[model samples]
Target: MVEAQHKKELERQLWNIANTLRGNMSADEFRDYILGFIFYKYLSERMEQYADDLLKPDNLTYRQLTTDQQTILDDIKQESVDYLGYFLLPNELFEVLAEKGKNGEFILDDLGEVLRHIEQSTMGSASEDDFNGLFSDIDLTSNRLGKNPNERNQIISKVFEHLNEIQFLLDDTEIDVLGDAYEYLIGQFASGAGKKAGEFYTPPMVSKLLAKLVTAGKTRLRDVYDPTCGSGSLLLRVAKEVGVDNVGYFYGQEKNPSTYNLARMNMILHGVHYRSFDIQQDDTLERPAHSAKRMEAVVANPPFSANWSAAEQFKTDDRFSDYGKLAPSSKADFAFVQHMLSHLADDGTMAVVLPHGVLFRGAAEGHIRRYLLETKNWLDAVIGLPTNIFYGTSIPTCVLVFKKQRPQADNVLFIDASQHFTKASNQNYLQDDDVERIFNAYTARQNHDKYAYVASLNEIADNDYNLNIPRYVDTFEEEEQIDLNAVASQIQQLDKDMIDIDKTIADFCAELNIKAPF
Candidate 1:
């Protein structure tokens, strides 16, 4: 409980700093700035701690080093690059900048240089790919920050001062809380980013569900992957399902440069070592940074019905060649499925969230659906979700679970959970109970009236391979078995009461010397 309170306070303090200092910038815009600064603060503290540990044998602390200690600093720099993947001088640490800002000194130029130095520190190192352009989204010269340079400096300095007031206690084991705080900020920013949120963030509940589905029955994973990694939330979520050490590595690809930077920060912030994650910045479908790699678990929440090139050249591509058809260029839902499936290890499990249309949409999508059932029989389960749970779109969606070597090879589990969510003023959400219920139903794999059903392969094929949730899990309710006799009795009573009310009005009209026209 104390830990929970600390986390709550940390998130509140960080969010307040973000909002109070952002002026009129959009949520996503300020998101880039605030998160960037917070990341810098985290790195500074980590560097100091690691350096202190290295100096312990000499009975010294990092802050005790003097300018004359060049040899010591050089030794520290080489080791830091190998272990922490970056280096910072005592003069360039986040604490020094915050102290300068607090002392009413201009540090914008210094701050920019420090951020650049951080990027350059990893040059030619194994971590270069992870650190390159990590700070590109933080454009210090943008006018959106303030009317002039001095004003920009003042606002940023204040942000630093406020952030410095909070101690993340990085040395504590709850360092995970710091990572959680970062995710909290991302989720908070996503709440206001509207439809654009889908581009970089998936709702926490959905990410958890997908993670659980993919990592089911496995204590450890060889590796996990997410092609549409976004801020790398889903990939990290998968690791949390099992202990982090249990997962060997993380592989992901994303297209948005700004969000790509955020993903790398998120991975490092979450304690995922640089050597453990290979996040590439590019279109997953077109480039597929990890095309030659296969993973033991795969998860994705690709853009709903997004458009893709669907070039004829892709038909012969290894990922798509076997399908005999491509998801239409207009709706790439099935296209993403085939891409993920291509990366699934023979014994791997894959779970993806997609629009409901993928279930019943005809044409190329229909052909692909048939091939999965008739040819591969890889689809394992279909679970419906409530609409409006997503930040951007209100369309209802479904989770499709696939396994190449399924023990239950004869049937598929269908769960209709569309109505199981808590409705808020602007959005509906899944309570823990709701997520657990769906997961339980998924594991049980039995028929429950109006909720879940296990349909045979023959039954699915008889319906022309349509996997729509409603087709198998019937949730139709007979309208409360309306009692006509009771309704008629109430109407009759209302008629009598109306007559009496009319008589009373007539009497009042007569007393006022007005005509009772009735």
Candidate 2:
């Protein structure tokens, strides 16, 4: 209970800071600034802790050391770069800047310089790529912040002042307080981002389901990959399922530049060492970054039915070559699937979220589906998801799990979890029970009335390679039979009662010597 309250308080504080920029900029722009400031503070706190530990032997503190002690400062900087993959001078620390702001001093230039120095410190090092341009999205010179330089500095300082009040608890090993808070802020931003949210963030529940699906029956993974990694959430979710160290490495590719930076920051803030993750900014379909690497577990929530070049020449590319035809130029759902399949190891499991159209859409997609089921037999299971579960779109989606080596090659599991979700304000969400029921059905691969089915390969082929959920999982409800005879009896009884009442009325009229209109 204490931890829960702490988390809520931290989230409230961060969101309050985020709203400070609301009047001056858009959600996406302010999001970059607020998160960037938080990341800067996180780095500063980490550096302070590390320096304090190292200085303990010298009976001196980092803040006490002056530039006159050049040799000692150089030694510490060297050590910091080796351990933290970046270096920040005492003056460059976040606290110092906040203090200067409190003293009514200008700090915009210094803050920008410090951020640049952090990136530069990783130069010619193993973590260079990971730290490069990590703060590029936080544009300090943008007119959106203010019309003049002083206004910009004031805004930045106010953000720092608010962030300075929160303690990240870097020394506390038992809790990931800051990391959880960071994720909460990211989720909050995604909620308000609308359709743009789909570009970089996956709903946490969906991420959990995908992670659980891929990591099932396994305690460790050689590596995991996401072809269209968005903020690396799905990749990170896989790590949480098992011990983080159990996953040998993390690999992902995102096309968006700003989201690419966020993914890197998220990794570092989550305590993932820079050396353990490789995130690239490039089109995963057109220019695969980790093409040579085979992933033991892969997951993705690619854009639904996004357009791609689908050039004819891609037919010969290794990722889509064997399919004999490219996915439609207007819809690239199958293209992402094929890309992920190419990197899946022989013993790998991959789960990807795609539109329902991929299940039954004909032409090139149908050919690809038939090839996966009949020719290659890599398709393993299909799980239908609820509609409006995502941030922006309301279309229903499905998760497709594939494996190169299947225990039962002749059967494919189908689970219709569409009806099992709780309706929240403006959206549907999968409760824990809902997720578990689907997972249990997936693992058992048995028939369940109106929920799950295990269809034979022959059955799928008979249906002409349509993997639509309704065809396999019967969720139809039959209406109860009506009782016509009982209804007729009740009608006749009512009519008899009305006739007796009319006769009684006629007798009363005769006693009164008045004519009855009946």
Candidate 3:
């Protein structure tokens, strides 16, 4: 408990530092700067540690190395860039910049150059794409940081110095202390970011449920993926569920450039090496970054009811060719489904969180639903979530699981978890037990009275392949009976009390000669 309290204090301290530098900037604007500085500090500490480990035999420190040690330093630079995917010079370290900024006597022009140098070093290497444009958002010349570049540098370096003071428990993999803290900061920022929160972050609880659902009966995963990777939290969660070492590769795509950078940084900060994850910055639907690969497990919480171009040209596209109709541009929920389904391996499974509208909404969505059920038989389960489980949206959502092949080919399980979650300040969250219950029902194929049911293809067809939750798992909680006689008696007693109060008021008004108050 003491340790838990300490960790909470650490998180609070980091949050304070983040908000301290924010000042008049909006949370989103300040978030990019603060998170960028923190990433820089993380890289610096990691580089320092790497250099320290390499010099152990020589009893030399990375900070103590001389610039004239050309041969030895070059060898170290080659090794460090290959291993860490980037390297920082002794003078370019985050601590050095922060100390110089606090002294109020140094310019950070060198610091900006160092940041660019890190990206340039990755060029012509396997890591070039990963590091390219990663620091584009942290513009030292932006007036948002300050009116002048010197002031901007001072603020950034100050933020770096403050970040350096906080301990990010990198060595303690037993706890994931830093990763958890980073996620907490991301969530904190997202709360104030309103609808924009949906762009990059999944509320951790929902990520957990999706992870567990996808990894259900599997102890090892060769690879995991998210088409709309966001900050890559869902991919990392899958790694945690079935030990990180067991995952061979992490693949993801993000349409937003800022979020794409965030996903790559998040993967690195969590100790997932550059070689282990492939994140692309582009529209997943249009470009389909990982089109050639088939993942072992997949999970995603894509933007709900998001719009897409749904151009007529995509009709011949392999992903939507089978659907017989294109998902309307107004709603792309089915488009994501089709895309994810296209990427699922013959033996793999995928679980996606989407709004409830996809289940019963007609037209293009209905046509796609029928094709999936009657043609592919890939629809596995539908799990309804409690309302407001996400940050911005309040409407209830549902998780749809798909498998290229299923052991139970004749039926699809539906669990109504819309009533199961712990309510927080502004959102609902799935507790551990809530997650377990849903997973157990899904795996056990349980037939609870109204909480869960496995509907046959014939039943689904009878309902015109609607796949709506209530059509299968009836969660219509009945209203309690009211005793009309007792209600009438209470109403009569209340009427007498009101009459007495009126008379008392009239008497008081007459005594005061105030024309008898009504």
lDDT of each: 0.93, 0.90, 0.85
Model 3: residues with Cα > 4 Å off, grouped in runs: 1-6, 169-175, 482-518
lDDT, candidate 1, 1-518, per-residue tens: 88788889899999999997678899999999999999999999989999999999999988889879999999999999999999999998999999999899999999999999999999999999999999999999889889899999999999999999887755666678888889999999999999889999999999999998988788999999999999999999999999777899999999999999999999999899999999999998888898888899999999999999999999999999999999999999999999999999999999999999999999999999999999999999999999999997999999999999998999999999999999999899998889899999988888999999999999999999999888898888777788899999999999999999999999999899998878
The 10 consecutive residues of candidate 2 with the worst lDDT sum are: 169-178
lDDT (Cα, 0-100) at 311 in candidate 1: 97
- What's the candidate order when arranged by decreasing lDDT? 1, 2, 3
* The candidate that achieves the highest TM-score relative to the unseen native structure: 1
Record all residue pairs in model 3 with backbone atoms less than 3 Å apart, i.e. clashing: none
Report the CA-based lDDT of candidate 2 relative to the real structure: 0.90
Q: List the residue pairs that clash in candidate 1.
A: none
Q: What is the lDDT of candidate 1?
A: 0.93
Q: What is the lDDT of residue 196 in candidate 1?
A: 85
Given candidate 2, what's the lDDT at residue 207? 93
lDDT of 2 at 285: 88
Score every model by TM-score: 0.95, 0.95, 0.91
Which portions of model 2 miss their true places by more than 4 Å?
492-518
